[model samples]
Target: MTTPTPVVFIHGLWLHATSWEPWIDLFQKEGYDASAPGWPGDPDTVEEARANPESIADHGIDAVVDHYASIIKDLPVAPILIGHSFGGMIAQKLLGQNLAAAAVAIDAAQIKGVLPLPLSALRATLPVFKNPANKHRAVSLTAEQFRYAFGNALSAEESDALYERWTIPAPGKPLFEAAAANFNPHSPAKVDTANELRGPLLLMTGGKDHTVPEAVTRATLKQYRHSEAVTDILDFPDRGHSLTIDGRWREVADTALDWLRRQEL
Candidate 1:
């Protein structure tokens, strides 16, 4: 018997999993069981996360991947995974492992085999990489940094509100691990792009994004070109890294929805 499709939402750094509530609502109304589970040690609320930034510290790529992998393994059925930023990387990893029915990666962080580190991506990771010590700590973004990295398309007022509501300190270890992935042969940030067992995978990009811009997603697409399973890429012009949390989030959500529907998922 076929079980209902479960849509698992994975959130990136600086935002709680609940940030996906809007997307969840949209998916649930469309007959999908949607959920957003945070990384290990994630605080229950935005306020709690802000105050206890260090609570999620010291976790690396393997740990975060395992956390989400375990969550999906317990689901009633394979899920249609949708994730943004670092969360997007997790989606790809799970897809490589054949743990998801389908996957959508939005402005995804670079995995080990995904070559090409855009200057924008490097700049965005500066907050954590600038200080080598941050690998063992948590790093928070200031208003200007947040604006530069995520909200450039938004006004000051909109950026501030988004920051107040969604931003939180993120663990630095994962960022470090991702940065060194290509050089580290033993890096856990690798993905199995050639696995035939992997399902349809889509890469979504923000044209104006400073972090994980179109170039980055395109590079990932090139890496996945070897996959016999369907692999595609879409671009949302004028959008930034904040596309997932910004006002036009619905547009991006609908695009993903339309694609999944086409796949009969």
Candidate 2:
């Protein structure tokens, strides 16, 4: 029997591993081992996270990346890493360690070399960094806030339900890190995977994404221009930063799966 490749999914901020249930299911059905690792002390459900936002306050990029690194160390084989938003940043970090067979970063946050910050991305993150006290706290978004940041292109009912099911308080420190990434010379979020020859890397962008705009995605592509292995980029014109959770998530998932199949992994 042929061995299956394992896939580790890292969710974006304000979301737990459970948020990737649909993607996980699709991956499993395709004969792959898939796991979604939660941030430290993440509550099991959205309701629980909403009720006790403080539990996620201590999770920063370093801690979260280290948690996944440990998981990869114990895996039977190096797995494909897939992440979105903050999770996308984590995926880039993992790829730099040469720990994965492949990786896909969807609307990932800014790292060291990529410097374009659209107004929409700034506005989406303003709630977390607006207050000094928020540095060590978890901040949840109101419905209106969620609508603008995550559901701008979806229907009202879909937007409302997504907010109810997936929105939660996220750690503030990662936002701070992303905000200051360009200024930090030694930041791990800065990935140098251009020399990695073992696996292909894919960077995807949501064309309508205010959180991580197409311009930023193009910048990321340029940074990886020196990669020895093939580097590719995909743009979903109708999707937003919440493409993984919004109405068209399946389409995005299928796109990634298609890429994986082409690699025959």
lDDT of 2 at 253: 94
Q: List the residue pairs that clash in candidate 1.
A: none
Q: What is the C-alpha lDDT of each candidate?
A: 0.89, 0.85
Predicted structure with the largest TM-score when compared to the true one: 1
What shift in Å separates residue 16 of candidate 2 from its native position after superposition? 2.2
List TM-score per model, in order: 0.97, 0.96
List residue ranges in candidate 1 displaced over 4 A: none
Off by over 4 Å in 2: none
Report the C-alpha lDDT of model 2 over 1-265, residue by residue, as the tens digit. Answer: 7677899999988666788999999999999999888888688888888888888895778888888999999988899999998888888888877889988999988777888888998898888878978879999888878877878878878888988888889999888877787788877567875765647888999888877899998998888877767788999988887899987899999999999999887
Each candidate's number of clashing pairs is 0, 0
Residues 1-265 of candidate 1: C-alpha lDDT, one tens digit per residue: 6566999999887788888999999999998999999999898888898889889899887888899989998998889999999999999999999999999999999888877888988897799899999999989999889998999988988888898889888999988888889889988888998887788998999999998878778888888777789998999989999999899999999999999988889
